[model samples]
Each structure stands twice: as C-alpha cells, then as structure tokens.
Target chain A: MAIRKRKSFFDIINEYFGDVEELANQFEDMFMEKPSWSQKNCTMEPLKDVTVTPKEVIVTVDLPLAKEGTIEVKPLDSKTIEISAEMKRKIRFDDFGITHHKGEFQRFYCQTRIPVPVEMDKVKFNLKKGILEVHMPRKRGERIPIE
Target chain B: MSEITIIEKRNIAPDATMLFGFPDVGLVGVIAASHLIEELNLEEVAYVDSKLLPPLIVLHEGLPHSSLRVFANNNILLAVSEIPIAADIIYPIIQALIDWGKNKKAKMMISLSGIPIQERQDAKELKVFAAGSTPEMLKLAKEKGIDILGEGYMVGPQAVMLQKCANMKIPALTLLAQCFYNYPDPEAAAEVLKSLANITGVKVDIKALLEKGEEIRLKARDVMKRTQQELSGIKKAREYDIPLYVS
Candidate 1:
C-alpha cells in the first residue's frame, strides 16, 4: 500500500564521493604532521582524544587550568574543530622550576581534525573539571526499511 | 660494554631502602621522586652513564647533570630519571640497577609508579595498588592496607625492576595509583607517596605538591609528550589489555 522513494543516480555518486573524501582526509591526518602554533611562543596545544563511534564522534581535550566561561569551540569546517581557552592565571616558566626560559603561558590553543564527516550544525560541547568534550553526529544518508 | 653504568659519587648506608622513580603512566613516579628529593633534601649520590642513551643532560642551577641520577640520604637511596628510558634498554638497565642495589646490600627496594584508569578524570577518590615481587613484600603491603594488584600486565621500567628483583631474591614492591595515562597527575603522585610512607615509614609532606598540581600539569606537557612517543615503542597499551590466565 506504500511506495518507497528511490535514491537517484546523482545521490549515489555524491555519497560515494563523500566517503572517498573522508577516507582521504583520514589518510592525510595519519601520515602528515598536524600544523601546530605552540613552537612560536607560550601557547600550548592541549592534549586531546578523539573517539569515533557508530553514531557520533566524541572529542575530549585536557585543558588543565582553563578558566570557566572562557573556552570556545568553533568548527573551521565540517571536518575541523578549533578550540581555544584562557587559563585561570599565567603560568611562568619558573613555576615549573625552569628559570632559563623567561616566558609565561596564559592560553591553550589547538586545531583538531575530525576523521569523519559530521553534522556541524548539531555539534554540542561541554567543559567540566577543566576538560572539554565535544560531540558531533555522523553524517549518514536516510535509513530506508527493506520490504 | 655494559648498556648502563652507575657512577657513585657518595657512599650511602648499606641497609638502605632503594626507591626507583622512572617515567611511566601519568609521570607519577618522576613527580613523586622529585617531591621526595626536595622534601627529604636528598643529595645526588650517583649518576648513570651509557653510550646507548640519547645525548641529553638536565641542567640544575646552570650546571649540567646526568638525565639519570641517584639521590640518597642516610636511610633511603632514590634513583630517578628525568627522561623516559627507551624500550630496548629497559631490561639491561633495570638488571644493572638491581645488581648494583644488591652489591650495595639494600635491604629492600620499591618502585613508585601509576596505573591508568579509563575514567581517571571522573574518579572521586584515587586508589593505590601494590604488586610485590615476594610473599614477604606482599604481606607487608597487606599489613599497610594497600590493595594488591591481583593480576595485570605492567609494562615499563618498573616491570623489569620487579622481574629482576624476583630473580635476585630482593624484596621489591611497585606502588601504582589510579591516574590519567597521559596527563601529569601530581595528586596521584601524592597518593603514591602516602602509600610509600605507610609501607616504608619514609614520610614527606605532600601539601606543596598537591597545591601546585595544575601548574605541574601545565609544565609537564612536553615531558609527557615525549613519554607518549616512547610509550608506543614500549607497547604500553598492553597495560590496558586483559591478561590471560595461563596455569
């Protein structure tokens, strides 16, 4: 009694290309060194973990000393995330018993690439105990029931 | 040529309890050892030298010092490494250290270290576990209310230390606190030190260490990064896998 909508030829081709693009992006991230800005100055690249599941991609960043309400998470594109946060106080080199380096750090900055295509508009984030967790749903085609 | 050589600068008591603090999960041992050195006012008594080691020297007060050094007072001899030890050298290096400890007639040996937990960040209270190389050491740990690590894969310098100590018949125990695998966890270090005090009667106030936890984490990032690199080469992920029970 019900009619099923068929996927068009162009839609199938687009899906195939999307998968290829994701695979290529993953390969690049695996082989290429990520571009980081920490070498220039006092900026630090916060340690992070990315776990991709069937439903969503979860990213957790360790941002110790990060102040509440000063953290920002922005999507550079559908496949990239930019995270920045201000530390509660400036940490001097002397603080760690290193007096030779006369510098201080007040911020944590990093740009992480997501391996899978994500629905950027639906990205959600939460910062707790100085750890930032970002969740984004995987981009997938509509599911159809098989008769 | 020996893979490692320990050059003694000062003679310590023959009945000393040697403590090993090598870089491992959470950098717990190194942090705990640094705290012990400062709090106990331990002096550099020996240094390890080897061509196999990467050309690295730590500077203190504008003076160059070996990356692997031993500190001691009257009753305690502490061996600590500023950098991570390469995997290929762990067995030989640990064997040498244990043999040297035996030559020194150390009564007992203990290694301060950490065990990684999946939800370390969410843990409200961290627990310290002990793995003893001998039954006497295990009994002592039980007497001190320290939980025994019933069975698990331990991968690092401490693992080799435990193995060598067992073969040499030296009483050794490895203390591990639940902690973040990649993060410098001073709080976990404090917990391990507390356990150390309980078992060995070597006491050091951990207030300053606890107060400066965040700053220590911030500064230890570079060392932690290097340690993470070495961790892969050492197959540290084995610590996370369930060990098979083979009779």
Candidate 2:
C-alpha cells in the first residue's frame, strides 16, 4: 500500500510558486506574436518542445542542417536553456524564392523554458539525426513523514 | 456569397481519385502532397477562396494565390493547404471540399496524415495505418497489408475529412504514419506516401525527398510552429486519450 501524508508548508509554497510561474509563462506566450526569424541578428529560431516528467524535464530542439560540432547549449538560469548552432550553409531569403527581403541566416538559435525546478548543473544532452535533446533531472522536494 | 467556394481555373476531369493533405502533425500531408505534385507534375486546376480564412495569400512566382488550392492531372486531384486551418473553419472547409470532389465524380477520397507516437525518435522503422469511411474500405486496406487504425481519437483536418466522408457515403480512408507531434518529419511523410501508393498504385520516387530531409525540415520550421499553435486550440492532446463508449 502507498503511504499517505499531509502536505508540508514548504510543499504548499512550492506548488503555489510552480502554478504562478506556469501561468506567467502562458501569458507570455499569449501576448507575444513575434516572427520566428530575426533579420537583424540573421538568426532563425529552431522548433523545440519541452516535456516535464516526475523525474526530469526533457527539451528537444530540431536543428536540421545544423553543424553538429558547432552546437552549443548553455543554462541561462535555473529555468532556461539557450541553444545556438551554426547552419551548414547561409540561407538567404532569395533561397526561399523571396528576393524582396534581403537577409541571409547563418545560424539557428532558441531558448527553451523549463516548467519544473531542475538540477541545471547535472544536465545531459546528445544530438541525434539533427535533433538535440537536453535532459535535466528534477530537483527533489522536501519529504513529509507519514504516520 | 457562399462562405467558401472552389474557383476552377481549368476543367477538372471526372472519376479522379481526390486526395487531401493539410497541415497537421509533422506536416505529413503537406510534405507528401507536395512531393506528389512535383513528381506527377500536377497543375493547379482550382483554388479555394473563403472569407472565413485569414487575409493572407501565398506568393508563388511573384503572383498571389490562395493558401488552399487544388492541383490535378489526369487521374489524381489533390487538395492541399499551405497554412494551418483554424479550428473554427475546419468543418465548413472540409464539407466544401467533399462536396466539390463529389461533384467532380471522384471515385475515392484519401487523406494523408500522421499519428503521434511517443519516443518516435528512437524508432527504427515506422508503420502506416489506415482508417476508412466504410467497412469494405477498411477490409481493402487490410488486404493491401496496411494496419487498420481501429480506434483512437484523430485530430486536425484529416479527422474532419474522415467524419464528413463517412456521413456522405463517400469511400474514403485516412493513411497515417507514426510521427513526432511537434517536429517536421520527412521520413514519416515518405512512409505515408508508400502506403498511398500501395492503395492507389500511384507511385513516385522518394529518393529526392529522403535526401533533402534536412532541408525540408529547416524550411518547414516556421509553418510547423504556426501549426503547433493552432493545434493546441483544437485540443489535439485529446487524441492521446482512451475512449469509453459505455452506454
């Protein structure tokens, strides 16, 4: 049988903060209608997905045509991962059959926000088939004693 | 004016097999339909104009065109959309397309798409599954050695197509390949197309598609992002739920 225990004060506070942070992230997503590319920076945003499990938070970014050796992932903070990669070739707007907007993108860049608290220092990642997956184990919460 | 209309530029031949490929998971349909168009040299015969759609228009060869268009040759008439079909407009758009295809005396209708699978990245081989409008169509797919999509919720344009086609008594089937839900999957697209060929005997070279997989994924990122946004509005996550049909 599974043990049942009452929530502790720290647990309640953690849950509240998590919900608030998640809501704020949703709000940020709602009001932002920015394009995926930056003409000034010549950087194209790669598509990414984040999955939060009980054990870890896994973030995967699709980086097709990205130079494997040039891929970089840095922990921006406790909750964000910034990834950058150099593309094999410069992609010009003309290459997409658009000559009007003159710009050449030489790299892929994006930031992934993790929802749950995780150990950023113990992060592990690998690139396979041009897909980069970063795995960070979740930070353990305080345990409550069961009677 | 009707809310949606298919304006025909060239006369379409009757008894053609109508196919649908709209933006959905992994962009399976769009990618497969695009490849079909290129390999078959299908020409634009009709375009769907709708007030329900956004004001955006696709620019091709410096000429503006509808985002939703129909391309055809002698035996195949394909309906493809370059943009994501919003949740609200899905019903009318699909009904209109079905009506148009029926009017054209389309022999059969098939929708190419993808079904999301967990950990698709590690899978060594992908399988294509089919859901048909009627039992006979399902049996036909079984005879052709394609797995049947017997149960599970289907989301997006392909779902609408299957439901509408079933009600209209039109022979239709949806061929879905296992694919990543949020990423552009060219391999899944190719798998779906091979099943399409088995069913329709309309085959095309997939070598070029596989070779340019990276390039296609790179170019398709923006569209996939927008499609992902639209997908959530439709409660696409519900597809993962198990249904209980107890009365």
Candidate 3:
C-alpha cells in the first residue's frame, strides 16, 4: 500500500525548475522579447502642453475625470516652471474572474521650461477642457536678444 | 546556422558603470541613454538581439561610463530598460543581468522608472519612490528621499531586476517618479530628473522632454480612443490605478 502526500509550493517549484530548466528557459525567452516600456497602452499623459502667447506662455495639460485644485505649479529657475497634480481613482477587478474590490491609485508630476526666463510673480494658471493652462510673461532677452 | 553575422559583441568591464534612465514608461530612459552616448561620446558596445524586442543598444563612454542616459527630450532615466512582466521571462532576464554584472565585476546595478501619481504636479515636487534588494541599497534609497516599496509588485524590467538582484545578493536601486500615465508627462520626468540630478549631479535640459511628452500625449490619446472603441465589447473597460501615489 502506498500513502499519498500533499505537495507544497516549494516542492513543486524545485521539481519543475530542476527537471525542466531547458523548457523553462525557452518559454522565458519568448516573453523577454516583448517591450513593456512604451506608453502606448496606458490611458495617461506624462506631459501636458502650454501655448506661448506674446505676453505669456499658455501651458495646457489634460487631466480628465479629475476635479479642480489637484494641480499646482511653481517656478524653479529663471527658465523653469514645475507642475504637479494628484488624481485618485478606483480600480475594480470584479469582472475578470476576480472578486469585487476597490483599488485606489493616484497619478502625479511634470515640469516645464519657458523659452526664456520669466518673472515668477507674474505667472497665472487655469484648468479648462480637462487641461490645466498657465500664462507667464516672456522674460527680457528670453526671446531673440541682440548680442 | 548559415552565415549568421554577429553585428557587435561586447562585454561589461570591471566596476561596470551603472547608467540609469527611464525607457517607455516615460521619456527619461530613452533620452538619457541617447544623451549619455553623445555627451560621453560612448561607442556602441553591443546590440541586444531578441526578435520583436526593442533594441537594447549598449554604449561605452571611454570606460563603462557611470552616467545616466538622458533622452533627446526632457525626460531622464528613471529605470534603465524595459522590463518583461511575466514571471517566466522575468526570472531569466534578471539572471542574465546578474551574470553579466558579475562577470563585469560590477558592484551594483541601478535602474530608473516613473509611476503616475495623483498630486497637483504644479509644485516643484514629484513624489519619488524607490525599491532595492540589499539593506545597503535600501539605505541608499532612503538617503535619496525615495520611498521604499514594502509590499507590492512592479510589472516592468526594473521589477525583474529587483528580484534577480535580490537572488544574486547584488545591490540594486530603482527610482520612480509620480507621473500622469495618460499623456507623455515630461513635467513629471523633469521632476524625477531633478532628483536624479541631486543624486548624480547631472545637468540636463527639459525642452526635449517637454516636446516628447507632448508628442506622446497626442499619440496616446488617439490610440486610447481607438482602443477603447475596439475593445469595448471584447473586454470590459480596464481601470488602472491611475495617478498613483505612494502612501
């Protein structure tokens, strides 16, 4: 008579890798070839746009399905302005063979540089079309300056 | 094999230089890599070959340039390269990197990446997150103000390297920026870059990153619209933990 024993995860892993290393290696190679770095698949933006006006540069960024007051902008260097926003969203996995659960996540950060340095005190921003816009005067000689 | 031509073959040198940058997750890695090659005048060391995989071109600047790759755009390298999420592929890829770094007498491995977090990115702050295998590495991460990941899974090349480095007992650290995932967020990249600059004292321009982000945002929006329509019936609306923030 033989006794049946329960198998543990460790035993299974050892048996699988020890005996089937070659098969595992081949299978692994296939996946290593796929690129997962591209932002093509995700529904988010890493940067926003701001149009430069004669008086000031109008910066715009998209933040759909988000309420106001989540984005903040600040001037860093003579030519740089920093922007950061936070939006919390819930993720549900009930549809994919997974039980219903709420998963919340926040997406944030970005920085922009003006063509020329601008006065930090003279910057203005607005959010429209799910886009945030900032207006700032162009710095003197920030444009085409005479040598 | 009949007349298989190997375009380039190279190896890591002693005290292998660790180049950190963001890849596709943001423009950081790609731009950083390109810039490092140009700034340091690094030569093409080797070209990684994997069908359907993006080119993994290694650049050597004099002697294993220990600088980060800056993108043509404003993005900086948050993580070094693309990471395959699947466990099967993840394990072996890490193994190869471990072996390569070891053979090169490398002391540690470094990677960079950015995550979309939900915070008004208007300020000069982009919450940075970090993870490492060794105690020393974690300490380094703390030294940099990068949040240490306690319990979670990162599904990219950086994640795979973390696991592999842990197994090999190699010191590794990954820096990630809180970024908006919906569009090419160069601003986020810039914030992350600032942190990297603080860590490495590397100066970079944000213009290229801004332009790249704008371009990526436009394209991604178009693709998302199409994908949403095409995948409507086939799959349920996939919700992501967007605008992610670290505690």
Q: List candidate 2 stretches off by more than 4 Å.
A: A1-28
Residue A49 in model 1: shift from native, Å? 1.8
Q: What lDDT score belongs to each candidate, Candidate 1 first?
A: 0.88, 0.93, 0.52
Clashing residue pairs in candidate 1 (N, C-alpha, C atoms within 3 angstroms)? none
Worst 10 residues of 1 chain B by lDDT: B214-223
Using Cα atoms with residue i matched to residue i, what is each candidate's TM-score against the true structure? 0.88, 0.92, 0.46
lDDT of prediction 1: 0.88
Order of models, best lDDT first = 2, 1, 3
Say which prediction, candidate 2 or candidate 3, comes out ahead on DockQ: 2
Expressed as tens digits, the lDDT of each residue in B77-154 for candidate 1 is: 999999999999888888888888889989999999999997677789999999989999999999999999998899
Clashing pairs in 2: none
Better by DockQ, candidate 2 or 1: 2
lDDT (Cα, 0-100) at B237 in candidate 3: 20
Tens digits of lDDT, candidate 2, B185-226: 999999999999999999999888999999899889889998
Give the per-residue lDDT digits (tens) of candidate 1, residues A84-138.
8998988776776866567777789887889889998999998766668899999
By DockQ, rank the candidates, best first.
Answer: 2, 1, 3
Candidate 1 has what TM-score? 0.88
lDDT of 2: 0.93
